[model samples]
Target: MVFLHARGITRTVELPDAEPLHILRGVDLDVEVGDHVSIMGRSGSGKSTLLNILGLLDAPTSGTLEFDGVPLDRMTAGRRDRTRGRNVGFVFQQFNLLPRRTALENVEMPLLYDGGRGFWRRRRLAAEMLERVGLGERMAQMPERLSGGEQQRVAIARALVRSPRLILADEPTGALDVETGATIMTLLDQIATQAGAALITITHDPHVAARAQRVFRLSDGVLHAEEPILEPAA
Candidate 1:
C-alpha cells in the first residue's frame, strides 16, 4: 500500500502584496511500508519544505496528496492535525526535548497529546519505548543530564510513543558526533523497521543517503525519482 502519494504538488509563498516565492515545483513521489527513503539536497533546495508537505505538516499550494489512497486536499484542519499526530512521527535535528522534564516524561508527552490512558497506562508504554532504544536506565534523567546520543534516543522514544505509521527525520544526526550519529541511525532503522513503519529521512550528507533503501535528489525545487540502491559501496 502507498502510505504516501504526492501528485504534481507545488507551493508558492507570497509576501506582502509582492510576487510569490516558488518553493516547490510539481513534485511527485510515493512511499510504501517496509521502505526507507533518504531525501538529499543542498540548502535552499527546499528539502525541509518538501518534508513538511510529505508528513502532512503543511499543505501544498496546489496539487493532490493522498495518504493510504485517501485524498488529503479536502481534509479539515482538525482532522489533518489528528491524522498527523496519529500516523506521522517526527525526529528533528535538534533534540527538542523538554529541558526540565525527565526522559520518561518527554517520551510520554506524545501520548498525553493524544489523550492517552491512565497513569499506569502511559508509564508502561513509555517505559517500553525507552527500553527499546536502550534508554531503560536513563528514564528518570533530565534532558541536560543525558549525552547527545542518549538525548536523541529519548526523542525517538517520544516519536514512537503513540506508534505512528511513518517516521520523518530531518537531519536527525546533524548535531551529533560521528560515533553517536552512527549509533542513533542504527537504532532508528531497527526501531522503525520493527514497528513496520516507513521511514523518510532528509539529510545533506552523502553517507547518510547511502544508508537508505532508496535515495532521491531534489534540486531547483524539483524532486527526481531514483532507482533503489542494492547497497552502498564499501
Candidate 2:
C-alpha cells in the first residue's frame, strides 16, 4: 500500500515587508511500507521543511499531501493531531530527549499523546521498547548520564515505542562517531523493518544517505531522486 503521497507541495513564509520565501516548491513524492528513503541537501535547502511536511508536523502552504490516501489539509485539527501522533515517529540529530527525564520516562512520552490501551500500559511498553534498543539496563539513566550513541538510542526507542507506520529521521547519526553511527543506523533499520515501517532519512551526509535503499537530492526547494546505490533483494 502507498503509505504517503505528496503532489505539487509548496511551503511559503511571508517575511516582513518582503516577498514570501518559498521553502518547498512543486515537490512530488510517494512512499510505500518498509521503504527506506534518504534525502540529502545542504543546510537551509528546505530539507527539514520537507521532512516536517512529510511527518505531518506542519502543513504545506499549497498542494496536496495524503497519508494513507487521506488528505492532511482537509482534516480537522484534532483529527490531524491524533492521526499524526498515531502514525508518525521522529528521530532527530540532537536526540531531543527530556534532559531531566529518565530513559524510560522519555520513551513513555509518545504514549501520553496516544491515549488508549497502550497509553494505559505505558510503563511496560516503554520498558520493552528501551530493551529492544539494548537500553534495558540504562532505562533509569538520565540523558546526561548516557553517551552520545546511547542518547540517540534512547531517542530511537522513544520514536519506535509507538510502533508508528512512518519513521522520519533527521540527521539521526550526525552526533555520533563513525562506528557508533553505523551501529545505530543498523539497529534503526533492523527495528524499523521488523516493525514494517517506512523510513525517511534526511541528511547532508552522503555516507549516511548511501545506507538507504533509495536516495534523493533536495536543491532549490525541489526533490530529485538519484539512482539507487544499493538495490534490495529481488
Candidate 3:
C-alpha cells in the first residue's frame, strides 16, 4: 500500500568557498495510498526541500527514493518526468495561477501534458473539476477577480484536474485567513479522499498540521514523528 517511499534521503548544497549546506539528513518516510501526512517545520527547516524530493521535483543527494515500488534513480529522466506528471499533483502557498488565464483554463493546464483522453476533453474535465471545487459559476473569471480563497480553490482544481494519485501541498493555507484556511483544508481533504489520493501537507502551523492523520516535525535537517492525539469517544 506504500505509494511513495524514502529512506536515508539526504540533500546537500555546496557553496563556492564554504562547507556544504546540508538540508536533509537521513530522512525516512513512507506514504500510503489515501494517507494524510503532514510535516511541520520553521522557515529554515528544509520543509520545502523535503517536499520537492517527495514530489520528485528534486533528487536526494544520497539514499533511496521510490514511487509505487519503482526506484527513482532507476528511471530515465523522461520516464521520471512522465511518472511525476501523471501521478503527482502540487499545491503551493501562492496560488500560482496564471494571471491572464481564466479559472477553467488554469484548471485545464495540466491535462495539456496528458496527450490522451484528458487532453482531448480538457475543457470538459476542467469544468467538472472546477464545479467540484464550487467554482463553476466563476470558471470564466480571471485570477485578479477572485478572492484569496476562490483563487486557492482554482489552484486546487488545477492540481486535481489530471486526477493525480498523490497531492503535495506546501503551505497551501499560508496566504488565507484562519476561517478560509480551515475551509480550504476541509475541502482539500474531502476531494483527496474522494479521489483516493494520498495527501502530504508541509506547513509551519500546528493547526494546519493537526489535520493530518500522521504528523512529523523537521528540525535541523532531521525528521521526527510526533505522538498522535487520540480523540475522546462520544
Candidate 4:
C-alpha cells in the first residue's frame, strides 16, 4: 500500500536581490508502509528541503503530494496541521524537548493538540511510549537531566506517542557522540520497525545511509541511487 507519493515535484525559493533557487526539480518518489529510505546528499544539495516537503512542514512551489491517497496541494493550513499531527511524526537533530518539562510531560505534549483522548488515557499512552523508548526510569527527569542520547530517546518517545504512520527524521544523530548516535539509531530503527511505520531519514553520512533498506543521493535537486548489495540465501 502506498503511504506517500509525490510526482513531478518542484520547489523554488525566491530571493530579493537575485535569481530564485530551485530546490527540488521534478523529483518523483513513492514510499509504502514499513519501508525505510535514507536520502543522502551534501550540504545545500536539497536533501533537507525534500524532507521538509515530504513532512508537510513546507509546501512545494508546484507539484502533487498525496498522503494515503489524500491530495495535499489543496489543504488549508489548519487542516494540514491536523493531518500532519495525525499521520506524520518528526525527529530532529536537536531533541527540541521543553527544558522545564519532565520526560513524561514532554512526551505528552502532542496529546494536548488532540481532543478525542481523555487526560488519563493520554497519560497512560505517554508513559507507555516512554517505556518503549527505554526511558521509563527517566520519566520524571527534565531535559537538562538527560544525556544527548537520552534526550533523543525522549524525542522519539514523543513522536511515537502519537502512533504516527510515518516518521521523518532529519539528522537525528547529528548532535551525539559516536556511541550515542549508534544507540539512538538502533532504538529508532527498532521502534519504527515494530510499529510498521515508514521511515524517511535525511543525512549527510554515507554510513548512516547504509542503515536504510534503500538509499537515494540528491544532487542539483535530482535523485540518484547506487545498486544495493544483496544478502546471501539463508
Candidate 5:
C-alpha cells in the first residue's frame, strides 16, 4: 500500500519585514507500507519542516499531499485532524513524554484522544505496547525515573500504541550515546516492521540514515535521493 505521497510540496513563511522564506521547494516523496526511509540534512536544511508537512502537523503553502490515496488538500480541517490522528505517529529527538506521567500513562494518552477503547482496554493496549518495547517492568516509572534510552523506548511505545500506518521520526536518537542510539534505532525498526508501518526518519547522523533501505539528502529546501549503502550479506 502507498502509505504516503507528496508532490511539489512547498512551504513558505514570511517575516514581517522580509521576503518569504522558502523552507521547502518542490519536494516529492513516496512511502510504501513497511518501507524504511531516511532523510539526512544539515541544520536549517528544512528536514524537520518536511517532516512536519509529511506528518500532517502543518500544511504546505502549495502543492499536494496524500495519505493512503486520500488527498489532504481536499479534506476539511476536522477530517484532516481525525485522519492525521488515526494514521500518523511521530517521535521526536527529545522524548516528548509528559514528565509527570508514568510510562504506561504516557502511552495511554493517544487513546484518550482516539476514544477507540474503554479506559481499561486502553490501559491494556498501552501495557502491551510498553512490553513490546522491552519496558514492561518500567511501566510504572515516570520519564525522569528512566534512563535516556529507556525514556525513548517509552516514547516509542506511545507512538506505536495506536498502531499508526505511518511513523515520522525526527532526530529520534539524537539525544543518545552512539551505542545506545544504535540499539534504540534497531528496536524502533523492529517494532515498525512488526507492525507493518512505514517509517520515515529525519536525521543529521549518516550512521542513523544508513539504517534505512532508502536514503535522501535534503539541501537548501530540496530533497534528492542518494544511492542506498547496502549492508554486506551475513
Candidate 6:
C-alpha cells in the first residue's frame, strides 16, 4: 500500500534583503508500506527540508502531499497533528533524548501524549521497546551516562515505541563510529521491517545510502533516483 505520495512538491524560503531561495522544485516521490528509501545530499542540498515535508512537520510551498491517500491540505491543523503524532516516528543523528530523563522515561514520553491504551500502559510498553533495542539493562541510565551508540539505541527505542507506520531517520548514524553506525543501521532496518513500517533515511554518506532499497540524490533543488549498486555474488 502506498503510505505517502508527493507530487510537484516545492519549498521556497524568503530571506530578508535577499531573493526567495527555492529549496525543492517539483519533487515527486511515492513511498509504500515497508519501503526503505534513502535521500543523499550535501549539507545545503535541502534534504532536511524535504524530510520535514514528508514527515508532515512542514507544508510544501506548492504541490500535493498525501498520507495514506488523504491530501495533507485537506486535514485540519488538529487532525494533522494527531495523525502525525500517531503514525510518524523520527530518529535523529543527535540522539535527541531528554538529558534529565532515564532511557525508560525518554521512551515513555511519546506514549504520554497518546491518551489511550498506550498512555495507560506506557511504562510496560517503554520497557518492552527498550528491551527490543537491546537496552533492557540500561533502561534506568541517564543520557549522559550512556555511550554514543547506546544513546542512539535509546532514541531508536523511543521512536519505535508506538509502532508508527512510518519512520524518518535523519543522518541516523552520523555521530557514531563506522562499526557502530553499521550495527545501528542493521538494527534499524531489522526493527522497521519487523514492524512493517516504511523507513526513509536522509544522509550524505554513500555507504549509508546504499543500505536502502532505493536511493535518490538531491541537488540544486531537485531529486533524482540513483541506480542501486549491486553486490558481487559469492
lDDT of 4 by residue, 1-234 (tens): 998999988999999999999989988889999999988888888887888889889998988999888899778999888899988999989889999999999999999888686355888999999998888899999999999899999999998888899999999988998778878888889988998999999987665677889888888888877565343232
Tens-digit lDDT track for model 5 on 64-143?
Answer: 89989999888898988888888888998998889999999999998888755545589999999998989999999988
Candidate 6 lDDT (Cα, 0 to 1): 0.93
Q: What is candidate 1's lDDT per residue for 1-234, written digit by digit as tens?
A: 788998898989989989889988888888998689999888888889998998888889998999877789778998888899888999999989999899999988877776546344888899999999998998999998899889999999998888889999999999998778878998999988889999999998666777898889897778886665453454
The per-prediction tally of clashing pairs is: 0, 0, 0, 0, 0, 0
lDDT of 5: 0.89
Number of the candidate with higher TM-score, 1 or 6: 6
lDDT of 2 by residue, 47-78 (tens): 99999999988999998999998999779988
- Cα lDDT of model 6 by residue, 56-145, tens digit: 999999999999999999999998899999999999999888999999999999999997899999999999999998999999999999
Worst 10 residues of 6 by lDDT: 225-234
**lDDT of each structure?**
0.87, 0.91, 0.93, 0.87, 0.89, 0.93
Per-residue lDDT of 174 in model 3? 98
Pairs with backbone N, CA or C atoms under 3 Å apart (clashes), candidate 6: none
Q: Worst lDDT window (10 residues) for model 4?
A: 225-234
Count of backbone collisions within predicted model 1 = 0
Which segments of candidate 1 are over 4 A away from where they belong?
Answer: 116-120, 226-234
Candidate 3 runs further than 4 Å off: 229-234
Return the TM-score for each candidate structure: 0.93, 0.96, 0.97, 0.94, 0.96, 0.97
